[model samples]
Target: MTYCVGLSVDQGLIFMSDSRTNAGVDNISVVSKMKVWEVPGERFLCLLSAGNLATTQATISLLDERGLAPAERNPSILTQPSMFQTAKLVGETVKEVISYTTPAGQSADAMFSGSFILGGQIKGGKPRIFLIYPQGNFIEAGADNPFFQIGEHKYGRPIIIRTYDPKMSLEECAKLLLVSFDSTIRSNLSVGLPIDMQFYEADSLKAGYKRRFDKNDPYYQTISEGWSDALKSAFDALPPFER
Candidate 1:
């Protein structure tokens, strides 16, 4: 399993994904679940994937192959005139890959399924984000919902729900996501990390800062340890229960 989040704030977009995949407790490995494509001054795209690793990787590989041979493949993700079209293309690719991987008479929605959180900006349009389902349909992030999370998301969702604000700065958004991830990592054995993060500033039309946080990263250590202590204090400060 994995955990990936795409957050949209007034300043820009923030994406983070954990890199752990396992067939069983004894067969754990790390594989990045984040894919990024950038066309400097024209657009920037980041995709956070969840679900079957084979399905997700094949989908991304097909997209990359099509992008390089655009004259043969009708719509390259890089050539899309808008972010919406780009997301549609990704959704289609995901559905196609899953269909091709599934055996005849078997359910494509079974082990072959995958989903994505697509976030980016194309030249003329304002930045946008979409949650693309395996069925080739998607929903956009808007005023009411400014973020999306995919994969092993349950353990980390509450913090984002309780704390998210549209006015948050890009840096603040990153910190919030790390805290959310830390919570998830502690609670789930399947979502271990070396987390990958990327930032895109509003209207920049290019990629911003990017980083990877491993277990030993100093800042991550600080956040993880601080959050544990803070949580214990908060619990202690709450009114005691008495029957």
Candidate 2:
């Protein structure tokens, strides 16, 4: 299992994903679930994946290969004219992977199913974020729903839902994501650390700050401990019910 999140804020977009996968309790491994593509002043795109490992890796590998080949030879995300088209391309690619990997006599939605959170901006368009399903369909982040999460998301969603503010700065958004991720890691053994995070400033058409937070990172340690203490204090401060 894994945990990945993408946020659409006024200033730009933020993406975070844990780097943990497991076949069993004893077969755990670390593998990045985030893929980034940038074209300097032209475009910037990030993909956060979750679900079957082979399915997600194959989908990302296909995108990477097409991105490096001639546009006439294959469909490449870099060739898309808008973020919406880019998302459609990703959705189609994901569906194609699911089909190609499904064994004979098995459904396409078998154990190899996967999902992705796509976010970025194209030269002539505003920034956007999308959640693409294995069925080749997707939905965009909007005013009412300015964020999306894939994988072991339930453990971390409450914090985001309760505190997310569209006007928050990109830095604040990053901090918020760390808290969300920290919450998730504590609750789900399948979602381990060495998180990969990326930010994209609106209209910049370039990638912003990127970082990795391992178990020993000082700031991450501080946030993890601080959040726990804060939560405990908040809980203790609540008035008790009358008997």
Candidate 3:
């Protein structure tokens, strides 16, 4: 299991993902779930994946290989004309990977299935984010729904839904996401971190800020401890229920 989130605001987009994977309680390991692709000032994109690691890695590798090849030599994420088309290419790639791994006439929805959150901007287009399903369909984030989460999402969703503001600064959004991931980390053993994060400023058409926070990172510790205290205080402040 894992937890990854992508948020879109007026200024730009923010992404966060936990790095723990487990075959069982005794066989846990850590690996990055964030993939980034950029062409300096031309375009910028980031992907956060959750589910079968093999499936996600293959999809990313295919995109990355194509993006690095000579221009127009073959279809690649870099060759797509718009963010929407880029998303379609990613979806198709994901579906293809799933199909190749699953036997014919058998359900492809086995343990090998996975999902992705793709966010960024292509030159000459506004920034956007999409949640791509294993079936190759996707939905974009917008004013009404400006965020997407895949993996162990429920534990971190309430805080985002309650406090998210379209006007919040990228800095503020990053802080909020830390707290959200903190909530999930405390609640789920499978979601342990070293959290990875990325930020993209709208229309910049270039890679943005990036960072990683391990368990001992000062700022992350502060947010985790502060949130616990805040929750306790809130619970104490509420009036007692009576029959």
TM-score of each: 0.92, 0.93, 0.92
Model 1 lDDT at residue 80: 86
**Backbone clashes, each candidate:** 0, 0, 0
- Candidate 1 local Cα displacement, residue 110, angstroms: 6.6
- Evaluated at residue 128, the lDDT of candidate 1 is 96
Q: For model 2, how does the per-residue alpha-carbon lDDT over 84-110 read when each residue is reduced to its tens digit?
A: 988898888889988877755456443
Cα deviation of 105, candidate 2, in Å? 9.1
Q: Which residue pairs show collisions in model 1?
A: none
lDDT for model 1, on a 0 to 1 scale? 0.91
For residue 11, model 2's alpha carbon misses the true position, in angstroms, by: 0.9
| lDDT (tens digit, per residue) of candidate 3 on 127-150 | 999999999999999888999999
Candidates ranked by TM-score, best first? 2, 1, 3
| Candidate 3: regions farther than 4 A off | 66-75, 104-110, 239-243
Q: Candidate 1 lDDT, tens digit per residue, 29-92?
A: 9999999999899999999999988889988988887545566753377888899999999999
Residue 80, candidate 2: Cα error in Å is 0.6
lDDT score, candidate 3, position 135: 94
